[model samples]
Target chain A: MEYTYTRSVGPVIDRFFSGLADRKIQGIKGSDGKVIVPPTEYDPYTGETLSEFVDVADAGTVTTWAWVTDPRPGQPLQKPFAWALVQLDGADTAMLHAVDAGDESRMSTGMRVKVHWCDEPVADLAAIEYFEPEAS
Target chain B: MRDIAVVATAQSPAIRKEERRNEVEILMPVVHDLRKRAGLKQEDIGFTVSGSCDYLQGQAFAFVTALDAIGPWPPIDESHVEMDGAWALYEAWTRLQYGDIDTALVYSFGKSSPGDIRRILSLQLDPYYLVPLWPDTVAMAALQARALLESDGVTEKDLAEVVSRSRKNAKDNPNAQLSGDVDVDTLLKEPMYLSPLRKHDCPPITDGAAAVILAADDRARELTDRPAWIRGIDHRIEPHSLGVRNLADSPSTRTAGEKAGVGNGNVDVAELHAPFSHQEIILKRALGLGDNVNVNPSGGALASNGVMVAGLQRIIEAADRIMAGQADRAVAHATSGPALQQNLVAVLEGEK
Candidate 1:
């Protein structure tokens, strides 16, 4: 049977997704003062619950990336694309997302990219449609 | 590590369809029954864990609704695995080893009859290569059965005998949905549903829920005079690709059996979660179970194959054997993924 999922995002996760809805990025501050993208409920290293939220620049450098020649069912990109581990500016850790680079040669670990928000607002990871190579 | 034991278990009656209630409603009574039999309250449970598949529920985070059955008013330390209930029990057992929580509750529920279970199981295959072919679970198992017959001396007659024995055993189990007396010779003569597998060779599509309560050392003694202490528990996963592994033998089960100390001590009984008649024979060989060991005293999955809950029921059935003084020691087995790609084994014993 066909089943549709309505997930209830808790307060912390809701806030992070809401930020994406507004075409912005949010990170929770760890006890060590590092801003973690895809904010965690608790610090993996210290096991401390984080309450502080901070906005980071949407523009960031690509850390490590794998090319998604074909996308899965619910992935951010509908067409052929690349999935990148992008370290948003002002954030300590990188988050995964699709990069809309036309060719694989244009995508590299040190290359720069910018957020490409979806046309409509929705509270999910898909809020940001993908990233594109930044113009020189 | 302290000795943890499964003291009580309860399961809802298997049905072809259950439209009167959703997952939580169906599970509430089963969970209550397990707690009531153990003489315990929700507050006494230190940890709660469950196993389920989102693909079966057709929704992501399907487990969240089922949590309502437990009533997390005070909030409890809990987690879930995208696996069978038997694996959830393994996680609970590991938590008990830390000597922090003395008691835990493990449960699993699935409504397989709501959808085509055979088609839904195909999604567990590798998304890239195998899922495109849309190979159903029954057809894959049939391939394995064909291999078992060719590689080993096992015949179609052996498969029919298993079906006959399981149906006969289920006659005494009220909760079983499929139970009757059918001659093995007649069963063999029946038409094949899938080549090398007759209609009786497969488990029925069933909807049900199951719950089991576990306690550690002193807590176990306080809960029951005869606690089925978990002597050993372990689980392993094999490669998901069908072509890469041998279908005739379950190396993962044999590896798990050795790790769980299945034959380290004497075992008087065994409850195997084999959904197919041939699979029980395969598992028995993999676990090194001798002919003297009593198998499937609770009728096993052939009687009521409730998808996710069937494996956990095996653990519960084995424990019940020890708790009732029917046996001094017992073994429980559970499997998951296509073609039994994952396996769990638990050894339980009466108080020393």
Candidate 2:
């Protein structure tokens, strides 16, 4: 028997993805003033609930990366790609995403990349297709 | 820290297809029987935990529907593992260590016959490299069996012997799905489902649910004069990739067994979760059990392999022996992931 799962996105996450739909990155600022990437509902270090959302720039520097010589099912990339931990321009921590760098030699830590949004945003993680290196 | 014991265990009859009812309906009777036999009410349970795979149910959050059987009107502290019931028991044991909850209920249900069991297991592999080829569970176990045969000089006859013994043992267990007296010679002559493995060598496709109740210290004594005290429990995981580790040897099981003190003294009874015949031999070697250990006195997984639930049933069966004064100390084991990539072992004992 086949089964399907319909997950209900909570309000905090819904707003985060809605922001992504507008090609904008949002982060939740904790009481400590540290901005969290992917906009967590609660502060991990303080254990306090967060409500303040701030827009962060999409352009970011790659912090660390692992090349996905072969991509897996449900991943953002269908072809050879690099999975980079990117610290978005105004965020304090890194978020994982596919890096479309054409080849392995072109991808490196500290390289600057810009978000390449999907043609149509569906309020899902895949709305951001992948990050590609900025044109030299 | 408080001592916890598995007081009661009950399971639905294993079947190829339980079409008349869904998971909740299938589980209600088992839950009722477990509560009834343990002489306890639903309200008496301090915590509940379950083990199941969303993949097996063909739906995510399958356990959510199953919660209906427990009747959550009062609300209970609960958690779930995307693993076998044995791991749920491990979590319950850990909870008991805190002395917060005295009584906990652990259960698991699976409908292995619903879809292609082998095909579904391929998802457990590293999704990127190995899964595209769709290597099923049987083929992977076959690889391990092949390694055992080539390296250790284990013969086909030995595999058949496990099947024969398991079926004979199952004759006494009404809950067993497959059981009968079959000659090892006849089993060896049967056509190979996977080469070097006969039809009986592999577990029959079974759909079933099982539940076990754990009571700690005073509650255990109040529930039964003979409580099967858990002496030790531990589990470990190996890397997901098959190429990264040795197939013939289960290092995870070895590590868990040592931590659980399987060979601390004498183990009168052993219940090892071996879905295939050769896995039993591999587990025996891994646990370092000699000829003295009475292995799978309750027929083990060869008689009824109920996916996520079978492993916990092993622990329950071993505990039953101690509770009934049939044995003093015993070892029970559970395995998960592809080719036994994860393992849990526990030691149970009765009052001296």
Candidate 3:
């Protein structure tokens, strides 16, 4: 069933999504001085409120990947694509997003990737259309 | 804490669809069978609780009708959880500890045929980041499988062997939806539906229900010749963010197993709720079960995963073995959320 209510992205995620709209990536710094990508409101380890926003590079490495032969409706790509958890540059944790590598043969762990932004940007995850393998 | 034991258990055969009946009809017979087995009526049950998901049917409060199956004429004490039945049983066990309840009935059911369960499962993820990406459950599981493959010396053959053993063991389970001999070599040759995971490596879409009863002290003795006494029970959960935790291991399961006293005795049987092949490996290591421990003798979730019902069925399988005099001590495990994020471990035993 469809929910008809609007969800508040809250302050922490609002900044992250706002960064997506500006073609920038934002992360929150944990107590250990580690950057958590696609930022969380509180420290993942300490549960302490975090406000120090860190800008991370859009380029990253694929820590793990799964090739989807058949695309489900509402997925990032209509064609066959791979789901990769990319540890964005400067971020300690991986961010799950679709990778448009054209074929399963091209995807692998530890491969370099960069965000592919949409033509028109919004404060949503859809702002970054998907990730694509970085050129050698 | 007072002694509590599993007195009766009943589960419907795992199937693709029960077209003729809805959730209530699907649950009635199993509840009927379970109550009869315990020789208890509705009023005799001190507390009544059930487990189910409204998202399965895309409707809210869908479990109220299933409660009617129990004939709650006198308005018996009741409750519900939007989680697996194992959690419902855990609640009942806690209530019995208050010394107010002598008996409690727990049941769970699910019908995955009506909706796209893969997409539906995404709702369980973090909506802001994970849900918007729309990574279906299979694709997410495939990520874990790949991490497992690259972590240790575990080969693709190890995964296939898990599927093969599950199918073979299910042959003897009357309630199993899938059962047969699976050739590991032939299975390895099959195309990967989601890379690092073949269709055979995943659980089938199953529609089923299960019921179980718990009694304390001398009341448990009146219900059955042998009550599977609950020695210890515990559950734990890690963070929901998949990116933050190591997918290759389940530390939550490890802690829960330890708290439940799994290592305290020689485990005669272990019924683990591992819907995916590689998860069995993770759980086995976390629980420290040896090769001598019988794992998933009833085929497990690979043979029949009924969402809300599967976890409770694991408890039933382990308890059934103890009640039947086939096993002396058993460890039962249940998991919820994506990639073993939430884990419940229980230890059951019979009088030696």
Candidate 4:
């Protein structure tokens, strides 16, 4: 028995995915003027449909994170990694992604990191394999 | 608003795993027990609603089969929420507001033991980004717990304290799945299950069900000498995306608590639906529960969380205390979605 379905990510988010396929990230400016990466069709706060899409740097700083000692199925990087809220550069909002920092000891808040893109462009969040510490 | 009160309630003992009974069977004794206590049969109930998710059993409309407990022979006025029983109770409470219904039967059941609950919960996340990550519930909670630790005054020790108190308080709750005299120091020593959240910080995957009978003014008086009168009830929700919301606080809960008029009177007890230890801290602050308030005297969702059932159980626990004359004013809270994104607050009181 299997239940499989595809969700429509809508027009605004579809563009964000397309950007990811080309190794680019985009943010939508909400009615509140906050640029939200992984853009939504409408503003999360004001419920207004967004029209502007701004390109954002793939690199960002970790606002917060939770280190996973044991990885679950389908998670990025089966080894020990941290699930972090990375507020990418040029975007006011954060994006949730796995940070392949090797161990819990390496993970820290405010750590500068950049996206680790997948070998092949895939028009999905998985197009970025995982985020890693930018310099090291 | 027409006066309505919780006159009677019943719940199965939270079990880690119920190998024998299916969902209907587990709900039978609970619903029947409430009927017996309220002296009302199936047909007498003006409205019937339940809360249960099909994901646990891996079948769509799986809740339809649960009607076996109600005996559909005569047919009944029934509805169900895909979320938790707390929301179903809210629906029944709303129905009573119409002044047409005299009584309602509310119940919820869940059997997390049969499924990979972590994976199932991930399905609730945004399909494109978060779902693909497949972060488990505990990991999500750990994220909030870490943020709370970093930003708020709450410490890891504070989380352990919540866990310790939950175990101690649950001793009085015969229906609770886990209860003991574990101390905070001992819990803090336990290795992290998902860093910042220990095994004790998370709720046990419980298989159980709970039911409550709601009666209007006069009918409520006739059913019980004391009734947990519904003073006010309201629920609110924050953004679904955890990244957008503040992980250290629960604005939805605060808004719901305010709308429910929790501050109108002195609350003696509060049954908060905080499945994770740190969440108790966040909810406590959001609802403005001072040190004097007795929180989760029934050990809350921490003692035994059956997902869909735990929220309604909070209402039952608070109402039961009010009905027992243990407290005059009490607040019962229920939460759903990731990291307390959705919240329901109900203020119940005893007759003056």
Candidate 5:
């Protein structure tokens, strides 16, 4: 059995998805100068509308991560991977994404990772595919 | 605020699966037991409210079917919340404030064995971003656990101790699903199911139901010899996006605890609904509970967590201790949403 539902992403969210489709990530500046990726309309803490958008580097440092030994259906990867909270360069906040590190031993806090974009542009979260260890 | 008290409570023993019994069947005996304890009939209940998720049962209006347990034939003032029973009790408490009603029946049930609970819970996330990733419950919890470990300087051994203590405390709980003496050293030796979290650190998926009979003032005293009077109650929620907030701390919990007056007096006992061991540590800090306070003496969610009823069970645990003359003041906490995104705190006290 299957079911389907549809919704409008609205202006604030639409801006973020549209940017993702073009392979460019944008972070909006909050009242306190913190940059929020996958931008929100208002600051969660200050409750002020944010308008300034800054383009952040695709590569970032992993603030925290959890290794998943077994993959469940619909996850970004089929094999073992690490789900990380990555603080993209120039952004104060972090975004949640999968890290394609091969082994648990390879993943660590403060490790540098860069976004691996999908082969084709898709205006959704999957467009980012997953993050890979940054090349030295 | 009208003086509200938990006069009576009953809960089914937590089990992995009740293969033969349906939701109504699981709830009937619990409802009957509480009513009998309170010595009241269906008509005597001024209002009825319950909490349960339709997604778990895989059908819409699934809660309506459970009404059969209440025998709604003669018609009754009833309502339901698509959340944990703790929220349902909150609604009932609010209803009693109008002075039109003196008594209310609150209950909740969950049967998660029928479906893949992780997949079902995934639907609760924001559809566009978080839901598309389909991160399961444990994985989300793992994310928080890692953050807590990194920022708080807590070690894996600390998490193991919490697991060991929870199992040991659960031995006294007849309704608990997992209870016994577990060695902390052995737990640390076990492989990580989700890195930084051993299997013992997680709660057992359970099927169960619980009921509480609430009364105000004189009605409360008439129902039971000792009533667990609600001294203070408040709840709060953080942002829905996990990325937007700090995972290491529960600010919402801290706020609710302060507003609920958790620090107003000595807390003899506290029943915190921390399903994850690491979460228990975060909650203790959020509520500012000292070492003297007994936390999760009934083993808490780690021992037996009913999907929709565990939060209510925490309240019942605290109330039971109060009504039994074991404690004068206690704090009961309930959490909903992924990674403790929302929290409810209530202060229960016994009559002097």
Candidate 6:
């Protein structure tokens, strides 16, 4: 069975979706002075409303990762990939995404990766297909 | 806070699949057994509350169907939480403090076999950023496991020992679905299903239900001879996002443990709801439980994890020891959300 429903992303989420469409990554400066990608309207700690928008690099380092040897259906990658929490260059917190390194031996913590933009940009997380190893 | 105690508890045997029984079918026997032990009918109970996820049953208001087991003909005062039964028990405990309701019946059930368990769990993630990626529970857990491994220098052998010990402990628990005498060396030799995680490190996919009864003060003594009085009960949660949170440490569990006064007295036994082997390690550290504490003598969630039921089972296991006169003081811990984002801790003790 399948169903579809549409709802507004609201102000905070709307900004994220619109930014993804233009392939320009951005984060909101949290009350703690840290930038958070896919930002939340209120500070996680203090619950204060946040407004400052900050641009972040499309590249970042892997903070921690899990190697998925067997991919499940509906997952981002068909082949084996590492699910990583990458700390985007300017963002204080990491964002979850898959890294499409060919082999398990190739993936490691602290490795740098750049976002792989989708062929046809869409206003969702799928706009960035997956992260790839950064060119040294 | 008024003194409340767990007077009676019952749990169905955990199994990989209940092909013949529906969710309601799986719950009926357990609820009947619990009420029978408490010697109370639906009408006698002041309130009824349950915890279960509608997503698991694949229908809206799926929990309402399970109410049939409780015989809600007279329309019992009831509530529901889309969480593990442990949280429902927590709510019931709080409601008992109002002094109007002296007794409450709590239950939770789940059948992870009927659906794509992993994919279905992904729906719990943030809709805008995480849900679209479809990260399974195991994969998400592996991220925390990996982080724990790197930060603490824990080896796969250490993880294997936890799995071996959990399964070995299950040998004594009839409700546990998985149990046996196993060697850590043999387990360590097994292939990795997810890098840094062996198959044993993950919990079994289980279908089961559990029911518990809570009574306040005099009513508790009337229901059970040795009531497991709740000395302290509290819960805390971390931010929803996994990115900013420290995967290596469970600050939520720590805070909840502190609030529950786990360190105030000696804990004879501790029941922790850790679905993964490494998570048990994290919980132990968070609770500040020493080697002196007997942890998960019932095999815990690693032996039989029925998504919404396991957490409550932890409380029952701890309370069971107290009622049996095996332990005087004990602690029960429950967790919800991925990577131990939310934690509930309850300290229980027998009559002083």
Q: Considering only chain B, report the TM-score of each candidate against the true chain B.
A: 0.98, 0.97, 0.99, 0.99, 0.99, 0.99
Specify the CAPRI tier of model 5: medium
In Å, residue B278's CA in model 4 sits off its true spot by 0.4
Stretches > 4 Å off in candidate 6: A1-6
The whole-model lDDT of each prediction reads 0.82, 0.82, 0.93, 0.91, 0.92, 0.93
Per-prediction TM-score: 0.72, 0.72, 0.98, 0.98, 0.97, 0.98
Model 6 Cα lDDT, one tens digit per residue, B1-352: 8999999999999989898999999999999999999999889999899999999988999999998767888778999999999999999998999999899999999999989888898899888888888998999899999999999768888788888889999999999999999899999889989988999999999999999999999999999999999999999989888898999899989999998999999999999999989999999999999998999999999999998999999999999999999999999999999888899999999996
Q: For model 2, which pairs clash?
A: A3-B58
The candidate that achieves the highest DockQ relative to the unseen native structure:
6
lDDT of 6 by residue, A73-101 (tens): 87889999999999999899999999999
Write the residue-wise lDDT of candidate 5 on B153-236 in tens digits.
798888888889999999999999999998989988899999878888889999999999999999999989999999999999
Residue-wise C-alpha lDDT for candidate 4, range B164-187, written one tens digit per residue: 999999999999989999988898
Model 5 pairs whose backbones collide: none
Q: Compared with the true structure, what per-residue lDDT tens digits does model 3 show for residues B212-258?
A: 99999999998899999999999999877878879999999999999
Q: Write the per-residue lDDT of candidate 1 for residues B1-352, one digit (tens) a residue.
A: 7888888889899887898888778888999998899888888899999987777789999998888668777888998988889989988988988987899999999888777788788788754334543556765676567657767699999988888888888887788888889998899889766556777888999889999998998888998899998888888877564433566899989999999899798889999989988899899999999989888876788889988989998998898878989899999999998768889999998976
Instruction: Please state the Cα-based DockQ of model 5 relative to the true two-chain complex.
Output: 0.74
Q: Compared with the true structure, what per-residue lDDT tens digits does model 3 show for residues A9-113?
A: 799999898888999999989888889997998987678999999999999999999998799988999999999899999999998999999999899999999
Q: Which ten residues in a row have the lowest lDDT in candidate 6 chain A?
A: A1-10
TM-score of predicted chain A against the true chain A, for each candidate: 0.88, 0.90, 0.93, 0.92, 0.92, 0.93
Instruction: Give interface RMSD for all predictions.
Output: 15.8, 13.9, 0.9, 0.9, 1.1, 0.8
DockQ of each: 0.02, 0.02, 0.78, 0.79, 0.74, 0.81
Q: How much RMSD separates candidate 5 from the native structure?
A: 1.7
User: Where does candidate 2 chain A have its weakest 10-residue lDDT segment?
Assistant: A64-73
